[model samples]
Target chain A: MVPAADNQTRSENETKWQLGMLLSRPFFSIGRAVIRWINILGAATVFLFLALVKVFRSKQLSKIVQQLYYIGARSTTIIMLVSVFTGMVLGLQSYHALVKFGAQGAVGTLVALSLIRELGPVLTAIMITARAGSAITAEIGIQRISEQIDALHTMRIDPLRHIISPRVTAAIISFPILTTVFDLIGMIGGYISGVMLLGLNSGVYFHSIQANVEMKDISDGLIKAIVFAVIVATVCCYQGYFAHMRRDSHGAQAVGLATTSAVVISCVLILVSDYVVTSLLI
Target chain B: MNTPLIKFKDVTKSFGDRTVLERVNLEIYEGEVTTIIGLSGAGKSVLLKLIIGLLKPDEGTILLRGKPVSKMKKKEINAAFAQMSYMFQGNALFDSLTVYENIALPLLETTNLKKSEIDRRVMARIEQTELTDAVKKFPSELSGGMQKRAALARALITDPKIVLFDEPTTGQDPVRKNAILSMIAQYHRKFGFTAILVSHEIPDVYFISNRVLALYERTIVFQGTPEELEDFDHPFKDEVIHSLEALQKELTGLYSKRQFKVLNHAQMRRRAFGDTYCIAVFTLEDINSIIRYLGHDAVQEAIRRMGLYIDKHFGVIGGFSTRRNTNEIVTVLPYSDITEAENILKYFVKDFQGLEINDIWTGVRRRVAMAGPVEFTILAGIAQGQPIAEIDSVIDSAKSHQKEIWTATMRRRGEKI
Candidate 1:
């Protein structure tokens, strides 16, 4: 009987330990993830601080210009293509929706408001994040893995000052400009679709858009563009710079992983921060 | 004694639960070529990175001159770092930049020197390393040897006080390995800077070393001059020496004639550029009698075992051996002194007598295992400061005078003088 009691006590202890593990596992993982995020944020904050301080140097101007060419000037064709198609779709769909209620005249207001307040900035950011952002991650990740980053450090050059600052600054400057350009092309596409193709009054379309679209709406879109720029640049650079620190092997796979993660995380952060900023502004 | 240029005081480093280095203490004096020899994962590279502050040690302190690296301010550390350069094992030249740009980058980034001055320094380094033809080419366009030289040029362009090399001879062909070693040694002489080299290429690296530190099993197992390492008698040290010998030679435990060509070229290079070396040829005098008595299989086995023994014993003092025609073996011992050469001869005679041959074909070609001592004598001649082109004549001279030297040595051994 005493042995039975002892066995029962041992079984109870085992169950208690298992139960404790089950109960604590989620908390443990969450704590680990939170710590990882905190560290990433701290590194990114320091990088951003250093970048801002070094961005104004005369030597950085050429690099920033080079970045502008790579990020902005070269990206014009794709942005135009996507924005024009999106505007045409919005014009066609909103025409049908408004015409059913005999308010087809208000199609311009719907198209302009959607593009200015949301579609323009969101789509442009996604495109830039896919195009230039992944490239940045790959370039920097290769440098990190190849020991070029360490070479720079041994040379007594701050990689943050030389490599990261121009990139982040260029992204910041490029996003808002690209968004504005996208909005303008989109309006033109809307006019073409709603007036010439759909047989609506062109003057009424232009007049309604101009009358209803406020400067605040455009400003909000630009602000979102800038915020998205920060998110994408910070995420990409942070991922690339720390690529060697991860458990991934230093090869094509590691650089690919860094690029993919940078794009995914930046997209998620952009969307979430968009909501936060929109709510705060409202 | 001179003060240490760099000092590691009880340095301990670990990754997770795996300890790489445990309380390691070492010192590198100024103007000395200190080579750290170790197995692949023995934390030799990590120790180098620790000295340069690329990776910090878990515990203990590294001092540059007398200043503790960990305690220095950021600006001070950067300033201190500027005085040192590292040639990475992979020759980490920037993939995107031309060789000229890659070498010039450090000067451009760190110093306030004018472009003209930077260009002059970069060109001088390029010239020093014989990289004039590959200046505008990317690293991928250059050969492995050229890339290493380019990396070396880049490391030296800054005129650093100390240069650190990581596995400078790993993955290199014998000729290129000799060239790189000779180049580094020449530059080290030209500029009296402290050099710390980490390599797995033993005995050969000793040819260019003022001292050696052997890292084994999470700590430094031995530290001394090349001569001292030759006398070091530990199981691990023996294993390291034998492994290095095995690594350099072919399956028969003898280097090929091709490797001989490389070594001869290297010896000529050392003779041309800096140091003096001696080449000794040892011919087995009674091979026909031994073969008649023990058969062909037994003789071959004896020769193979003798190859291993010669490699182990003579290999200690940068003496590399290779088999010649059939009955002779030639070894190049990189020393200017006749005493060291004589010491090799003495040790070889003593150790060759003790080497036992076990397998034999005897009694109507039936395989029999016999453990017995073999009777043989070695006739050797020493030639010093000869070029590769002149080596054949010296070897021939050694062969023709073999009888006189043998008779004289035998008379002396018998006290018949």
Candidate 2:
């Protein structure tokens, strides 16, 4: 079979230019692309399981330890910083609003409720986007263009298994613990503000925080945070994975574009997801 | 053919009305280094992409180890890519990662290998490609040859069963070219992988890859052993051999003068001192086929198209255009040296060469001459410095010399003086 040489050339030319827009399009429907998304999701799930199997088979405790540090131990600073700031802001806003009705003491319970219900999870989501999201997106995007993804495929190793799954699982596991820490720190900020800044009783502040935040609220916030974590991680991985699909195959700019796009998308998605979770809970 | 490891059966792909690949069938056996050789835009790269599952065949099937590529998921298809290594013409290394990181990336992503194990394996590959010194540097920091080596290191890091080299010798100096070829040969030896190389570096690639597939006229015009290609005995084979000989002659005679023997009185102005003249055609590889393909019409079209493309893009062309005929235009550049003429010819000739025809029917091709995608190739030929006052014999000499080289089936190297 022979194709017309000129026609073949022309088609190749068109494909090269359209490559960017075509590759980028998956970002739009991939989440909602039902069958495609499900296929990818199911495969991703299987890939994760396979990786876990390999890890167990190989007895790779060191890799697991390194991942624990990368996902959990190293993220503490940003996590703590986000929670404290969210706490202080919640304290200041609640002070003015509750005091206007001569109910300034409710600031303790209000801060706890806000942090457990929304602020802790939402702030953690934003922080992780800046921290974990950027690292994962950039790393994978570099791999995508560098053909490391292709290299993995050559080695008969599903890149989704060792590369994407670990990060995704790490995010899911880490975000809840991170959100719990944020929730605890945020309440402490409320307690400090109430005791020192507002001259409220420390006993009352701590008691209010402890009683106001229930297991259900904590559980719900943790669940939402975990979901947001998965979204951010997966979106970044997807961006990086599909980066090579571009014909022009952007170099550094592609990585940057993907990371920025992932961040923006993840941030927006986190907010939308937050609303949905809050509504369902109420 | 012993149950080919890979086979392309009537595979055709089109983008809208323009077709990239058409019902193309090819069989690649295991353990053979098959080189696909062709000119730029000949769809060699597209073929590689199709086999790697980067693109799908719109018409037929690509079987790998008896499985269809079109039916595989990206992961499954991508899994096949694990069995292969592809070297891009651009040496598309990750700009952000250090060389070590680039080599270690596949292991980190795909294998359950520990960091130390990945590092150890990467170090071995780096050593294999002699990129240990460059391990810490990014792709930008390395020299062109070193970057190529690093890219090769990255490709071979995972020990793929098949490797694809895309214009591997392009942009490389002769030394670097040979080194890369031998490096590829070495990897092919150690891994026993089937190497599918895409390149125009025939003299170099022909040594390593036993089988050659020449993509000409959208068909496999030449597919055989190097001996078969040398003795191809077909008109097309003659063209290739003639081309190689001509190119070699062109390069070696760069500084040598061409003695022209003026035959008739009409060519009198071209000589000096007597009925003899001499001029050196330093660069012809870039412009010779072009002249043959389009004739004089191509030259004028090149000049005009160059002017238009320059206005649409960026480039400066100021010279004289001699209207030899309605279709043939010869420009005798003044004030500019021979090199400048080469540069000028490179830019304006594509439109004249019929290469730009694709741009008209399909809006997909990047006019790299305009897009800054690549710098244009430039070459120059120098005319003898004999004064026009005694020029008859000089014109005769130059003309005769040109005739001799043009008529000779093979290049005559030692006929000087």
* Model 1: share of true interface contacts reproduced: 0.59
Candidate 1 lDDT tens digits, A1-282: 568889999999999999999999999999999998898889889888888898876478888999999999999999999999888999999998999899999888888889989899989999999999999999999998888888787777778878899999999999999999899888888887899899999989999998999999999999999999998888999889988777856677889899999999988988899899899876
Each candidate: what lDDT?
0.79, 0.64
Deviating ranges (above 4 Å) for candidate 2: A1-75, A244-257, B1-5, B15-18, B29-31, B52-56, B63-85, B88-128, B135-141, B154-161, B186-193, B230-417
lDDT of 2 by residue, A67-177 (tens): 667877788898888788778878888888888898887888999888888988898878888887888888888887776666455445556665776677677778888
Error of 2 at B351 (Å): 49
Model 1, position A272, has a per-residue lDDT of: 93
For model 1, the stretches where C-alpha displacement exceeds 4 angstroms are A1-17, A248-250, B250-417
Tens-digit lDDT track of model 2 for B1-417: 589888888888777787866767788889999988766776898888777766677888999988887677878766677678777777777676799987787677567787888988998877666566788999899988777777787778778888888888788654355457666766776689999988765454666777888776555677787657755556655555446534532322211011112121234454344332223221223232332222222222333343233333222333222111111222233234345544554554444335553332122121111111211222323333333434334323323433111111111111111
Q: Alpha carbon lDDT of residue A164, candidate 1?
A: 95
CA lDDT, candidate 1, residue B305: 56
The DockQ for candidate 2, computed on C-alphas, is: 0.17
Cα lDDT tens digits, model 1, B1-417, are 776888888999998899999999898989999999888888999989898889999999998888898888988887888899999988888998899999998888777899999999999888767677899999999988789989999989888889999987777655456457756776787798889999765545666789999888888878889768766778766666667766766445667554565677776775654455666776667665554343333344445555666667778877787776445777777765556666767666655444321121122123112223345555777765445446667667556645312321111111212
